[model samples]
Target: MRAILAPLWNNAYLLMTLTCLFWAGNSVIGRAARDLVPPVGLAFWRWVLAFTLLIGVAWPYLKRDREILLKQWRWVVALGALGVGAFNTLLYSGLQYTTAINALLMQSAQPPLIMLMAFFLFRDRTGPVQIVGVLLSLVGVLVIVAGGDIDVLIHLRLNPGDAIILGAMLLWVLYSVLLRFRPPVHPLSFLAATFGIAILFITPFYVMELMAGRRIVPVAESFATIAYVGIFPSLLAYAFFNRGVELLGPGRAGVFLNLMPVFGSLLAIALLGERFTTAHAVGIGLIGIGLLLTRKA
Candidate 1:
């Protein structure tokens, strides 16, 4: 793996950074999309479209590896639940009740929390430096989620948005560990299958909502939002992320995703008119330092 990845790390780094930015933009999209589409409807259709694209693009491989994918059906379903079903669903749902800044801060906790969960769940070894770095990054995450207020964190009264974001974190952690464990048949083929199968999983919930008559009323603007989610975050971002994981390996690639919150916060300010404050600056510095310390030296 090292020999294969060494030559591609540079390109992977660039691609992953772009993935982070895309995800940050996704947050903005979700926020802007509120009220225009039902959260569940947006989540459901994005995957439906993504599934279509992946099927077309990976049709040859999908046919070739049909047996292997069939054999790994459980993993595919598991990954689909965590990666597509849970993550995107929670994101859209949270955006309904929370500010984009709140959502981004909560999502930012993924890297450190994933490391901590891996250590405990899998008995992975952790050094003092790593533990400290994780803790430091976690503190930053807490600060951001608390809206730059230590008092709110101290009170332990986290906002509902934070809870939703935490759910997204847990979903991804499970996805990460699952990827490490019963990996799909082939990396690229697996990614394609994982995404291609998402629509099937999300369809039931969408159907229920539609039966209840709460589906987003289709309009030109609504179509644009769904199309944006399909192409940008679901298709392009996943492609970038998979290429990064293939090139840099999952560990390094995971750490690079830390940039998502930073980018999200900045974009929130620029696009959403969120105020930039001292606490945000401090949190950024701490998370940056933590990532630097955790990086392979």
Candidate 2:
């Protein structure tokens, strides 16, 4: 399969899809384990877990290619900050006050932000179709976020968590764009470094939260879910996303942002027993159309 799909296989699609699914599960898990993980502490511990895994798996690479990574340590650390640190921080923080609806809906905005950022930062081109696609996906996101009523937004009832999620959305776009200029480190080593450094940077928060009597415990069916988040979403998700951009270019992979809401909404209902609603379907369709419009030619 690897040999046959080399020309057409989309690591980006797989990465984006897995990310959406993992994130969807996280949403459900967040609601269930809200008390256990807390907000900032949860984000802090995810990096702690991811950091330990990366160090164990890629420590050799770090030692072997120390010089190469050192040559670009600045960018690597910066990427780690935005990609792993700020984004996850914003996500977990937002999850504290927001519903899964806001979390997923805000994430849907990443494509346009990435596209527009890439165009401005790197002089990439954007066409009419891209605009339409962005607008379309946006409608679905808004519908979903507003719970399909639109009136909710008008009533000024949006939660603070929603804004935090939006911050996370922007962080992802910034991270995606940065992937285009990634250092010359192996993917594993890069992920390890990114997660590791992010953990280092975020440890104080974790300790502070811990000192405040916050403890990490399981909210999912098993403690293994935390392990899964570390292995798959944190490690594998980062690897595939980076690989996708490396192989397909960031411009093309940005379209995958649209799929998040589709998968997130479904998983939320299944894993978390979240109620399905007509508004969700409408939002999904609109986001679908918008995402299609943004696909690369």
Q: Rate the local accuracy (lDDT) of all candidates.
A: 0.72, 0.73
For residues 1-297, could you state the per-residue lDDT of candidate 1 as single tens digits? Answer: 878865654477678878888887887888887878887788888887877777765777777888988887888778877887878888787788876555655666676665666667776566667656666666665665566876765665457876787787788777765566444455557767777666677778778877888767667878998898988888878777766766654545566666777777788789779898887788778877776676542
The lDDT of model 2 is 0.73
TM-score of 2: 0.85
Clashing pairs in 2: 137-290
Candidate with the greatest lDDT versus the true structure: 2
Model 1 worst lDDT window (10 residues): 177-186
Query: Looking at candidate 1, what is the lDDT of residue 73?
Result: 83
lDDT of 2 by residue, 53-109 (tens): 678768888888778878988888889988888887777777778876556656766
